[model samples]
Target: MSNLLWLVPVLPFAGFLILALAGKHVSRVWVAIIGAGSVSLSAIIVLMIGIGFLLHPPATGNYSQTLWTWMQVAGFNPKITLFLDALSLVFVFVITFIGALIHIYSVSFMTGDKDYSRFFACMNLFVFSMLLLVLADNLLLLYLGWEGVGLCSYLLIGFWYESEVNGYAARKAFIITRIGDTAMAIGLFVIFYQFGTLAIPDILAKAPVLWQQGASIATITALLLLAGGVGKSAQLPLQTWLPDAMAGPSPVSALIHAATMVTAGVYLIARMHVIFQLSPIAQMIIAVIGAATLFIAGFSALTQYDIKRVLAYSTISQIGYMFLALGVGAWTAAIFHFMIHAFFKALLFLAAGAVIEALHHEHNMFKMGGLKNKLPVIFWTFLIGSASLAALPLISAGFYSKDQILWYAWASEGGNPWLWFIALLGAFITAVYTTRMMIVVFWGEAKTEIGHHPGKLMTVPLIILAFFSLFAGFIELPHNFGHFRLFSDLLHHVLPETVLKAGMDAELQFQLLALLSTFGGIYLAYVFYYKQPQRIEKLRQSGFVMNLYLFWFSGWGFDKLYNVLFVRPVVFIANINKNDVVDKLYQGVTFVTIRLYRSLSFTQSGSLRWYVMGLVIGAIIILSIQIML
Candidate 1:
């Protein structure tokens, strides 16, 4: 089973190769099978190996398989190896399993599309890249997988090449994420230079001996890695691209947001927990960024009218919770939320896809009304996902995962009151936007007629995901409740246990406050959007409120701010240098070469005497040069 680990990523890569080679010639049915079946097979392998890992833990508490050496230079040898442990196993399971489901859903969702095979090819490649990312035993290999997903994102997001807007969105995602990728690359170089290795186990083992707590070197490397994570995960300042990324197909969004690309950063932080632990400054920065991002993205979600755009912002906000947990040393809690988030966020995106398809490609929630009755499957599944996103008390899985973060944000040794308050406020805003989305899209009068209903192909994945969104929390419950520790206990081998700064006496009080925020946000959304719509309209009419609404809707004007700060200046310089010194230098070389060619052409006049004379002149010149030398 351990040796077979290579098959996990290979299956998807093989699928991608097949589809890319013969896709145009194959029928759509075969395309679907080749695409979805490959990932499905990978999922089965992961599940079997996962069970083996649990039933019979390895002697080292991890399984590593080295296929071959990747490169060897200057005594730096990194192998093409896969490392499987409790942590990477968790991510691999999600990437393969949830990824398989998304591919299956894409089968039906992409029917009749001209580029059906192309879409599946990019998807399989995307999954392969992500699997490699989580499975890599070394940072260099990990970075390869990281860039693979970035390239695949640009390909899939702008899949419908006919759409200019989609192209812009794809470029935006690629270029912005590249900023973080650059930082991560530099971080990796520093790690290798300092530790003389990029292997995960080696780095973790060596970090403490090499750098003291809060050392400048440790802090610098950690901050650089965090910048990379922030960009890839769509955190503040680098977050503006995600909302526009909704321009891609919904299944693509699910893959990127839920199970793969966006979560790569969270996995990075968790995977290299020792580095962050050694740098308290970097850790605190993570918490502040996470808290601020969640709050900001929640407001953006609130202002979105596009259904997918709302979920896009919701993803940014949810990942913020994961970051918050990581910053507070709640490693298990962060990964736990990541798992639960995968379930519900994928459900939401797929369900939203169904709605969009049924409504003749309408994206605006205002145009979508009374869908609960029209599309019961999507409505029910979407409602479950929404409830989970809102963390609706004890019923939804989100309550367990999110509440854990809330507790740790206040109770952990690294946590502070201010972090807790910001997180709590973000939770409330999350609920408000979620409720607003549900009402505007699923309730109210029917504004658009349904064109079609989702088949079992599409609905089954939603049903499966919705079940997880509802029940996955049972594996890890609160102490005052069942105190189930199955999830956290499994992660104990790889991640350190979170230490509490306070006793459990205030747990219930904190839980109650979080519940109040959730319920209050829901009730407020009901009042403003559902019950008295006039109130929302009137509030929007107010000058200040309207200004705020526009600001949030514009994603806090980050795009405009960036344009002024970066894009405009660069464009201006580019325009001024349209034909600058470098161009003239090249043009002069071209002019001289053309003149020489013309001068040389006079001797080639189809005359044998002229040709012989030219050869004689060339020989004379060569003989004179040799004699002089």
Candidate 2:
């Protein structure tokens, strides 16, 4: 089973190569087969490997397959190896499994696209890169995969190159993520310098021996890595890129948001858990960033009129929850939420795609009312996804996973009441925005005629994801409710169990508080957006309230702040330096060269006499120089 580990990532790479080279000559059916089939095959292999590992656990609690040496220089030998453990296993499963579903959904969603093959090619590459990122045995290989996804994102986001807006979004995603990537690269450099190797296991084993818990190097490295994760995951300061990323096709949005790019940061922080543990300061920063980000993004989600952008903001907020869990040392809980998030977020995006398609590409929720019966499959699935997103009590998988995070936020040894409060507040805002989205999109008066119903290719994926949205949490129930720990148990070998503060046993109270926040937010949204729409209008009439709404709608002015701080200065510099000193030097060289050329041209004069005279003069000058020497 370990020997077959190489096939997991290879399959998708092969699919990408085929789609890139021969897809244009193939039919759509074959394109779909090659595109979705590759990831599906990887999913099957992952399932078999997972079962085998469960039945016959490795002594070292991990399986490493070395395909070849990636590089060897100065005692730095990193192999092209695949590392599979409970952690990578979970991520690989999500990437390949949910990735396959999104690809299938894309086959139908992108039906009339002129660049259908190109879309699949990029999608296949995206999956392959993400798989590599999770499975790589060394940081260098992981970085390769990291930048691979970034590049693929740019390609897919700008797939509709005809739209300048889409192009801008793609560039924004690429450039913004690069900031964190740079920090991560520097962190890798520090790690290699300290440990003399890039192998993850070697680094993890050596970090503790080389540096104490509060060592400066350890803290710096951890914070650097966190910066990288922040940028890739679209956490604060870098989060503005994600909402605009919705300019891509729906499945692209689903794959990037739910299964691939945004989750990369979570995986990075989890994979480097040892470093974070060594730096309490860095860990606290992670917590604070997560708490602030979730609150800010949740508020922003409430103001979005575009359905995808709302979900986009929700993704940011949800990832913030994952960060919060990680910050509070709830490692398993963070991953648990990640798995559940993938299930439902993907469902919501796919269902939204169906609704958008049914309404002829309408994106504004206000313009898309009364879709309930017209698109019954989509309405139900979207409702299920929204319920999970809102963390509606026992029925939704989100409730269990989110409940665990909330519990650990205050109960863990590192946890505090303030982090818990912010996270809880975030939960309320999440439910409010989710409820608002549901009501505004599906429960109002009919505003647009249905364009067409979605085909089975699109709807089936939504149904499958919707199923997980409701039941995946059962694998990790709360202590007060069945105390199921299957998910955490599987991860115990890879990640440490979170420690609870001494004498803290208020899990039940925390759960109830989370439940109330969910229900309260839902009821409030229902009343304001559904039952009494006029209330929103009256609130809008208030000057300060409208200003606040506008602020949140503009992503809390992060973009504007960035424009003033970063964009304006850069543009100003470029405008001022249109013909800078360096250009003047080159221009001067050109001017001198042109003058010399004209002077030499006068000697030619397009005549035999002029040519003879020039040759004689050149010979005389050369002879005189030789004489002088």
Candidate 3:
């Protein structure tokens, strides 16, 4: 099984290469099968191995396979190795499972498109890169996969290269994430310099020794890595690109925003839990950033009319909650939330795709009322997804994961009650926006004509994800109810358990807090959107509130700020250098040289007498100088 682990990423990459190189000549059906089939096969293998590993666990609790020596230098060798442990197994299952579903959905969603082959090629490549990211045993190999996924994101986001906005959106996602990638690369270098290796397990093993020697070194390294995570996860200041990422096809949006790329940051921090354990300050920063991002993105999501953009902002916010969990030392809880979040979020986005397809690409909720009967499959799937996202009690997978995170936030070592308060507020906001979106899009009278119903291919994935969204939470039920802590225990081998455990009484307090937050959010959404939709209209009419809403709607004006601070200034400087500096200096030098040569050329005159005199004069001068020497 370990030996075969390499095939999980290899098969998809091979499919991508074959389809990409020969797709133009191949039939579209073959291309679809090759593209989707490659990932599906990998998913099947992963399921088999994953189940076997889970049932008959390894004694050492890890399985490693080194494919080959990727690079070797003096005392530095980074092998292309695949590792399957509790952590990597979870991510691999999600990447392959949700990834395969997205691939299947793309087949019907993208049928008859001219560049269908190219789209599938990029999708397969994305799965390959994402799999490598999770499976790699060393930081160098992980970075290779990291950059590979980013490249695929840029490719797939702008899959329809003919649209200038699509190309622009792709560039935005690439450049913004690159900022974090650069920071992360530097952090990796810092780790190597301090620890003298790039192997992840080795680094984690040695982190405690380094921390005990000099705690500041560990803090700097951890913070730098967090910076990288922030960028990749679309947290806080680096979150503007995600909303605009909707320019891609719906399946691409579902994959990038929901399943794979955006979650890389959370995975990174969780992967380096050892380093993070040493830096309390860094952890606090992570928590605070996560809280801030949740509030900002939640509020921003409330204002979005574009269906995909709303879901995009919601992703940022939900991932922020996961970061908050990680920051608060609830590593198991964070990953638990990540697993459940993947199912519901992907379902929501895919369901949104179905809605758009039915409404002839209409995305605004205002234009999408009363779709319940018109698209029954989409409505039921979306309801299950929305219920999970809203964290409805007992029924929602999000209820289990999110409740645990909030509980940990209030009870963990160094936990602050205020952070929990803010998180609760964010949760309410999440419910409100999600409810408003659903009501406006599916509950009211039909505002647009429904063109066509979605095919079984699309709805099947939605139905499967919906089931998970509803019931996946039972894997981590609270202690008061018999304490089925399967998820936390399964993940303990990989994640660090905090020394300070919350008291039993504190558990009840945490539950009350979570219930209030969840119900408050639902109530606000019902009151504002369902009971009194006119209030939203009135709020929209207010000048101040309208401007505030607009600002949030535009991603807190980060795009404008980037344009002014970076883009315009760089363009202006380039223009000035091109016209005033380089042209003037270079052309001026050329003009002087030309004029000097012309003036000097008059001495030649092209005459035999002049040539003879010039030669004699030159020889006399040379002889005079030689005589003086």
Candidate 4:
């Protein structure tokens, strides 16, 4: 069973190659089977492997398979190896499992499209890349997976290539993520330089002994790695691209924004936590970045009109909580939240897809009202996802996972009142926007007629994910409940222990505070959006309120700021030198050649006498030049 770990990533790659080669020739039904079947098969094998590992733990507590010696030099060698441990196991299962579900959903969601085969091909390839990322044994292999997913994103996000905006969105996602990828690549170089190895275990083992806590090298490495995570996960500064990434198919949104790529950063940080733990300054900055991004993204979610864009910002905000958990040394909590988040967020995106299809592709929540009956399945599934996202008390998975982070934010050894206050405020904002989106989309009067209802293929994935969203948290309830931390216990072998342990008194206090903030935000949302809708509308039109509204709607002008700061300057320079300065030498040669050709053309006046005279003159000039030489 352990030997089969190599097959997990290979299956998806095989599917990708098959689809890429045969998609245009294959029937659409066959395309769906080859696409969805490939991933589904991988899921089954991963389940078998996971069950086997759990039942018969390996002596080393991990399994590694070296497929080949990838490269070797005098002192440098990197191999094509796949590693399976508690950490990679969690990510692999989520990716293959949730990813398989999303691929299934996409088949029906994309029905009647001309590019169905292309869409599924891109999706299978995306899963293949992510599997490589988690299973990679070395930093070099990890980087390959990192860039592979980025390439797949560019391909899938622009799948509808006829649309110029979709192309723009795809490029934006690729370029922004590349900034972090570049940083991560440099961090890998730093690791090899300092530790003389690219293997994760080797680097982690050497980091603590080679560099003291808060050493400059440690800080630099930690920050560089964080840059990669921040960009991939859609954290602050690199986050603008995600909202626009809604330009892709809804299933693409679910896969990238939910189960896979966005979470890569959190996984990267978690995987390399030892280096981060060596630098308190780097760790503190992680907490601060998470705090700021959660607030910024939460407020942005409030102003979104597009249904997918709202979820996009929400995705960013949710990942911020994971970063906060990582920063606070709640390693188990961060990963636990990531799992539960995958369940709910994927559910939310898929359900949103069903609603959009039902309404003939309408996107504005303002325009979509009272879908409770029209889209009963979608509404209910989305409600489950929403409640989890809002961190509603007890019943949903979001409550347990989010509550863990909230408690750790205030109770961990790294805790400060300020970080807690900001996180709590962000939670409140999360609730407000989530409730607002639900009310606007599902609770009001019906604003439009329903079109095609979702087929079972679409609703089936939603039902499965909804089940996870509703109950997955029970596996990891907060510690105050007396050891319902099955989720954390399972991950304990891989993660480090946290210094923060709450006494009964402190746990009870934080729990109460979190509950108030949770319900308080919900209560306020009802008062503002549901109960007194006109008052909220009036506030939106108010002078200063409108300014803030526009700001949030424009993503706080980050795109515009970047345009002025980066994009425009580059564009301006290019325009001034529209014909590149480097090309001028060629251009000058081209000018002389054109002049000589024109002069020679005039001499060839369709007469043998002119041709003969020109040849004689050219011969005379060649002889004169040779004599001079």
Specify the highest-lDDT model's number. Answer: 1
Compose the digit string of candidate 2's lDDT tens values, residues 447-510. Answer: 9899889999999999999999999989998877775688888998788978776432578778
List of clashing residue pairs for candidate 2: none
Model 3: clashing residue pairs?
none
Candidates 2 and 4, the one with greater lDDT: 2
Q: Which stretches of candidate 1 lie over 4 Å from their true place?
A: 591-629
lDDT of each residue in 1-629, candidate 4, tens digit only: 99988889888888888888989999989989989998998999999999998889899989999999999997788999999999999999999999999989988888789988888888988999999999999999988999989998899888888999999999999999999999998998989989999999898888889999889999999999999999999998899889988888899999997767898999999999999999998888899889889999999999988999999999999899999989988899899999999999999999988888888799998889989988888989999999999998889999998887888888887778888898999889988899889999998888878987898999999999999999998988666777767667678878875867567789778878878888888888899888988898789789999999999989899999999999999889989786887789889999999999999788768999878888999999999999999
For all candidates in order, the CA lDDT equals 0.94, 0.92, 0.89, 0.90
| Reference-based TM-score of each model | 0.95, 0.96, 0.93, 0.97
Q: Which residue pairs show backbone clashes in model 4?
A: none
Output the lDDT of residue 614, model 4: 84
lDDT string, candidate 1, 156-249, tens digits: 8999879999999999999999999999999999998898899989999999998999999999999999989999999987998999998899
Positional deviation of residue 599's Cα in model 3 after best superposition, in angstroms: 12
Candidate 2: where is the Cα deviation over 4 Å?
502-505, 603-629
User: What's the distance in Å from true for residue 18, model 3?
Assistant: 1.0
Error of 3 at 471 (Å): 1.2
Off by over 4 Å in 4: 579-581, 611-629
Candidate number that wins on TM-score, 1 or 2 = 2
